[model samples]
Target: MNTYLQVAAADASEHRTLIITLFSVFVAATLGVTVWAGRRTKDATDYYAGGRSFSGFQNGLAISGDYMSAASFLGIAGAISLFGYDGFLYSIGFLVAWLVALLLVAEPLRNSGRFTMGDVLAYRMRQRPVRTAAGVSTIVVSIFYLLAQMVGAGALVALLLGVSGDAGKNVIVVLVGVVMILYVTIGGMKGTTWVQMIKACLLIAGTLLITFLVMLKFDFNISTLLGAAAENSGQGAAFLEPGLKYGVSTTTEIDFISLGLALVLGTAGLPHILIRFYTVPTARAARKSVIWAIGIIGAFYLMTIALGFGAAALLSRKEITESDAAGNTAAPLLAQNIGGGADSAGGAILLAVICAVAFATILAVVAGLTLASSSSFAHDLYANVIRKGKASDREEVKAARVSSILIGGVAIVLGIFAGKLNVAFLVALAFAVAASANLPTILYSLFWKRFNTTGSLWSIYGGLSSSVLLVVFSPVVSGNPSAMFPGADFQWFPLNNPGLVSIPLGFLLGWLGTVVSKNEDVDGRKYAELEVRSLTGTGAH
Candidate 1:
């Protein structure tokens, strides 16, 4: 078996042609869709909200595609393959976060928001300051998240195309960046939505097929597969337990909790996900979309268990570890093995299909991130804050297109430098920032009658700054051998994730800022109007 894998590993170059072919097909199809959507996207409403035309089912699939990025598919599967049950926890946390989005955010956001999250947040507050704060939070979270996707794209290109060195990775990053910029600038919301919907279907189908194949190998018995995975893991039964990855010490346990908090709260504040609600016509459509998203996302996560454990059971640890230290290549390698070893025809086909799906995954996610960031800049900052809500629709749309190009350029540059950083950790940091900075302000603005512009601004800045600073000083950045800068020793912060501390601080700052302000009575008087609008969809754009 080892010799077979060795021969398969040596034959990777033979698979490159297949990978290129499938990737070309995917890019061509998506670009065609973008062209069609671009022709129809004439104004700000069409660019940002798809003219509020998506049905619940279509938006639901698009939401699933947007949420399930390369991190969810490749990252989680890789984590589970490398660390066992601890990796499965990420899937659980991500699925649970949708519940927060559905129950707490979806309907109200759809009712109050138009083009961006700032619309909902600044509805009752002073528009300029509030929109500026929301815009900053949106850009911060979107950029962090976009960096992870871009990094993943580089790694995937290197693996699939049999390329090596920084030059190859840089070329791949530029290609991804250019494609994503076009997707957002041309396709806008309508184009991006259809792209997401198509990708979602492909991803779900590919995952299902792979899961079914893995099950067939195990005689359709899940317990048998788990036992085999444990035996192959070399940790005996312990590999099936939670302590393998995240339970090293008291600090690690706290880190796990912090990560959980961020994952659960983050979805409600992700600007791209929030904006999906506005693509639908009404609050009811938004609620229905969340339900559809939860169903699709939950099913996808459940199947990831099969993909992860199947790789563990069927492939040697050394083979998976040596291919990519972070285990990002696990799923594709597993597919190659399961389809009959790398040298076989079936193996090459399966590998190419999975690679295409992964490529589509990154494309859909980065496009959504670009749209969210650009829309926040154009709609919140340029239109509302700078233009005092006097900008023409054409001007706002043009600004959004320009912003997309700038954001995509930044992501490409950062991704080239980021190299092979663990995509999962980058995603977690992005979530923590969203939970800390955006969630508190959103919750208070919608539910707290005393919440004012001062409170919202404080919450956004406090959460954003605290999360970034803590992450900079945390063990993830330095001190630990695996840290980004292993030679540096600036790890004063113990926890890798900052959610446990920063989330509470964000809420505290919001409350304190509101109480210290003199506009309490004035803000309170507006609550009745806000409440009526939020619940009844009155005066909503």
Candidate 2:
């Protein structure tokens, strides 16, 4: 009996059970929110688009919640700890994408759309076919993004509970999938937004609190922390300079550029993020939401800068190693090390908060993704394709609920399979695909009057094909021997990311296709008139 108790205590010491318990409570609270939201989900619009009643600020907060996932939270911190200056590249890249969204897409997207990005593009050109393609793209991107979050969740749970890998991730997948389904299934956009708002607040607060405390440990000296971080960051001179690693190798520069493009252009194109704009009531509200979202997300990213450096300076040696070299666990493990290395209750509280934030982040983000995919399948595909354009609101809502469950199940299974993949790389692939397939069509539909059905089709096909092919040949996919076409694993390309190449290709194809198909047959004036009314709210919604 004594030996068994000793074993239990040791497990507690290693696993940090208290943190896991706290995380469970957070999930319970989110579930309660989901239940409340379910009560409000009464019709198709409510279930699929939150009845389009959200104000700018509410929607903005929800966007932040949706955009900031495990990859941003834990993966960024881990990158900073292990890769130093290279990690900040991601932060810069991520922030740049918002600029693209604000300048090029936000108001036009809100003005043009009801549910999906496909709606925005196909509104004038070829509604049915364009909507179909957009729906396919949204689901594909959401699944990729979802799998990354699920993998991160599993890693987090296993680290916190010291459980077997499969068990820990499966628990997160089930919990997150169920909670997200409930959020969209019940409250619809309204409910999903509320949950995201609460989670975003919690996440920002938690990160800020940790950053503050870590600074306090150094007498609030920022430079001192940086110096310490530089000394401990493992890569020596490369710790402070971006191009010092591998002496500006062609491969390194290519990867860095790809990362930058993904962060910038991809932010504007993600289906889950784009759909949040629709939750707002007006185009002005959508634009306002973007500004607020930028501020909140910028502040959160700023704090991560501190958190990442703090982990490297204080816990680098203790929390990481060469064999298990990714350093993804640095953030939570560093928290534990802060208060006597997971033994003290203080450490437990910190771990619990971070873990809780992680759990909440996953639930909020995944719910939004599921909701986006569900909307695409239900409203875009089913109503338009399966129903011959006559599906009722009741049918759409029911189909949405059913689709939500199916997509969630797929994400859970995929997340489990992608257990060994890099969280950051998976997310980057989602961005690449979104930039390629969705962005070009949306942009041309809004701004270019000459864009016709052929242009839109070619853009979708070209962008989608290029992004997928690039990813297949990119280092992450090809580097894996077990991946299909293992010989392709030896990358011929320099960039690890494909957004730079794929996004431009999407735009070029759309333009070329437009030119080819516009020899006096296209009604450019009528399309421009439609766009003008949509942008200024001069016509029917």
Best by TM-score: 1
The collision pairs in model 1 are: none
Candidate 2 lDDT tens digits, 1-541:
2332234235456556565668767877877887887787777767767888888998888899998888888777777887777776677777778998998888877776777777777667667877778778888889989987887777776666655545666786677676667777776777788899998999998888888888888888988888888888766666777774323787777767777777778888899998887787788998999999999999988888787888888875435532123455667766665655555666666776677787788888988998899889988899987786799989998888899899988988877666666566678788888888888888888877777878888888888888878776766656655332345556555566788888889999988988888533254665776677567755525
Give me the overall lDDT of model 2: 0.76
lDDT of 2 at 181: 73
Candidate whose lDDT is highest: 1
Worst 10 residues of 1 by lDDT: 1-10
Question: lDDT of each structure?
Answer: 0.88, 0.76
- Candidate 1 structure quality by residue, lDDT tens digits, 1-541: 3565456645667766667778998999999999999999978889999999999999999999999998887888888888889988889999999989989989987887788889878877888999999998999899989988887888777777766676988899999999999999999999999999999999999999899999999999999999999999887788899888788788889999999999999999898898999999888999999999999999999999999999999987887766666677788888888898778888878887887898899999999999999999999999998999999999999999999999899988877766656677778889999999999998998898888888998999999999999998998778866676777897899998999999899999999999998675464667777777778778888
Compared to the true structure, candidate 1 yields what TM-score? 0.97
